[model samples]
Target: MGRRGDYKHFLPLQTRWADNDIYGHVNNVAYYGYFDTVVNEFLISQQVLDIHNGPVIGLVVETGCKYFAPLEFPQKLEGALRVAHIGNSSVRYELAIFKAGDDAPAAEGHFIHVYVDRDARKPVPLPQQFRKVLETILV
Candidate 1:
């Protein structure tokens, strides 16, 4: 598929000193952290997840990444997040890491979260409000 519009939500991420590698570029692994941060921040802001005491929690079932360019430390990143898919208790979160003011993405990836009951750890259907919030971000 072709590229779509930017995500409805954005989370700014500050690159740390330790994030850079010997090559002077941000390590690829750190992108995963950025992805997690952006999505979770959205969930929290939307009040869709309660990390400490919620009855439901999402467990990542799949993930992937694709790098388009290198990133360096001391640079602030704008992580654009959107929902690509929503299934039974599962959602695919698509992320694009962009340098401030740039239209193209430095990195793009997606992760699938299967929601489960906090206690039983069994798959559960997403709540109506939760799905509603995610739907606004669907790409």
Candidate 2:
């Protein structure tokens, strides 16, 4: 339901041939991949996430999506991202996918990530640096 302006950041995405199903559209599950890619791409690009060695890591605890229109392969896409909520140990990321240059979202959803200690896997307060980065995209 989000418009392009609702998001603070956008990442370009390409639909691969394998992403399409026999029905001639991108599968429902592929939308989730787009959502995940945009969020992590932003975090990594901002240097806040060290996936291979960071002591604090985020684990997805919840996620959802709603499709409004079909997306087909061989199309360019723009994945939009924003923060809906930030808590002591969790953050809710809202995301949407649109055909490149389109303002209306083809799909939209949210996912909650609970930051945890990499080894203990116990919930922990989000790192100050990470939290600050997320704040920049808060909505």
Candidate 3:
């Protein structure tokens, strides 16, 4: 497990039946989906991300995961999100998936997103407002 204070925000996630594979556990790929969903929803809720005409967009550049326990469908999850690092045009997001109410995480991972221009899709500096929003979630 990672440091208990690594994350600053928590989002509840309800696992769906399709999230589990034939072996009856959540597929590994589904964890990444949870990560993305939590982060994006946070941004949207904060009005930092405007998918329709946002000048700046985040593009995933890297991702990784490590499972410490198994998670099955119908289980409720609490995904914790935090900013691990912030660079010129990129941010690394650390995620921890916990079965609801569990102090220790079932899995932990991180993914990097490089902000870019929506039209040209070229790397751009992190906008001031976006940075501020992210700062609130930084551990």
Candidate 4:
């Protein structure tokens, strides 16, 4: 809601050549990838999420992005993250893409991840460990 500093965690990202589109700026779709990368990385680092073997997995049900500026190749960027909301089986993550060395965000967005059983794909309450980590960064 304010600046990059407002988020609880940050993950630096290296812009790949392919991230830029013909317009010479990072494509909108690529921004989502950046968002997912940071969220997943944090979960993995905390050992709350296991993509390959965990019984619970998150399924994104909603996502939206707002562009404030263009990002080009070779730019160093950071993905800032915080939890905006947490339901019984879903959590809303707020994210901002900030150009390295800048406090302002180049883009802002939110995505909702509904935790579900990996096998049945039915919504399930978030694990205690998952909820605990999310609480630390809840906005």
- Using TM-score as the measure, the top candidate is 2
Candidate 2 residue spans exceeding 4 A from truth: none
Which sections of candidate 3 miss by over 4 Å?
none
- Tens-digit lDDT string for candidate 2 (1-139): 7799989999999999999999999999999999999999999999999999999989999999999989998999999999999999999999999999999999999999999999999999988999999999999
Query: How many backbone clashes does every candidate have?
Result: 0, 0, 0, 0
Ranking of models by lDDT = 2, 4, 3, 1
- For model 2, what is the error of residue 69's alpha carbon versus the real structure, in angstroms, after optimal superposition? 0.9
TM agreement with the true structure for every prediction: 0.95, 0.98, 0.96, 0.98
Whole-model lDDT per candidate: 0.90, 0.95, 0.91, 0.93
Kindly give the stretch of ten consecutive residues in candidate 1 with the minimal lDDT sum: 1-10
- Tens-place lDDT digits, model 3, residues 1-139: 7744667988999999999999999999999999999889899999989989899999999999999999998999999999978899999999999999888899999999999999999999988888999999886
What is the full ranking by TM-score, best candidate first? 2, 4, 3, 1
Candidate 1, 10-82: lDDT as tens digits: 8888888988999999999999999999999999999999999999999998999999889998998899898
Model 2 / residue 35 / CA error / Å = 0.7
Please give the lDDT score at residue 30 for candidate 4: 98
- Pick the winner on lDDT between candidates 2 and 3: 2
Give candidate 2's whole-model lDDT: 0.95
Error in Å for residue 130 of model 4: 0.9
